[model samples]
Target: MPDKQFAPGCGLVGTVKLLDIGVPTTNLGAVRCGEARAYAFWARNAVAPAAYQILGSELAKIESMGSYSCRNTVGTSGPVRLSGHATANAIDIGGFVLKDGRRITVLNDWASADPALRQFWDVIRRSACRRFGTVLTPDYNAAHRNHLHLEDDKAGFCR
Candidate 1:
């Protein structure tokens, strides 16, 4: 467990608690996030198991676009709101690698012509919806065209 303090800017006003999931847990590699315990548990339990079931291979790594930033939500109109990343409570997953040397990326594989590839992304997205309160996929908007935004919030919004 690690804690980080950020200077006041970009909608961040105080010290932010963080957890680094950079160490390999199960077959997944580094993923830096704010909600470490919950995210790590979900990765090890829900994500890895689902990947094995769908891909018939052990998950090797989870490619992330990092986490914990002081920023506003993208592609939104109206008043700008602090992004979940502002407090280190969300992560953007861009892809995954499997032990069999297969790489699945949201940008390329989410709507892939291959049925198996499409199914894999669909299953993973649904699985993430079950655990993370907010799950935003490429389908959500063009701003999320290449990653799944999983946030530890109470929004109950998954798309």
Candidate 2:
């Protein structure tokens, strides 16, 4: 079933309905198994806002790198360890596709993307760090060489 939550009094926003909140979570110590209010709120406020502003009023869909992976960080060859996602404390954003049939992939587009697209992407990436406890980008490491990793890490690391 989908888990719907409100994004609070963020600037122009509505309820975020995460369809297929899918999979029961056993790693985050019973945070209701899906996106917690804070994470949802952060994503909506941090990422969604920029989506509309940057995608230009013609936004189509937001592509997700993925969420809720029951594994360890990439290149960690081992028995699956807990990922930030396991705690519902992380979100992986890959890219965006506009209504004009344009495919903007994070890996390829971030550097050479049009000025507007690059601005939009950078805005959101920086915004995520400002809003979330931790934000990882392609520059962070090979594990996240393609997507933005937004997490509510109490350590206050923004790399």
Per residue, candidate 1 scores C-alpha lDDT tens digits across 22-107 of 42433222223435555777777766776788778988878878676778899899997888877667788888888899988888
State the TM-score for model 2: 0.65
The C-alpha lDDT values of all candidates are: 0.72, 0.58
Once model 1 is optimally superposed onto the true structure by TM-score, how far is the C-alpha of residue 78 displaced, in angstroms? 0.5
Worst 10 residues of 1 by lDDT: 23-32
Give the alpha carbon lDDT tens digit for every residue of 13-132 in model 2. 122335423221122222322235544554456455565677664445566665554455565566755566554456677776656777677788777747887787778777666666
Clash number for candidate 2: 0
In candidate 2, what residue range of length 10 has the lowest lDDT sum? 6-15
Off by over 4 Å in 2: 1-17, 20-39, 42-49, 75-81
Residue 50 in model 1: lDDT: 69
lDDT of 1: 0.72
TM-score of 1: 0.80
Instruction: State how far residue 118 of model 2 sits from its true place (Å).
Output: 2.3
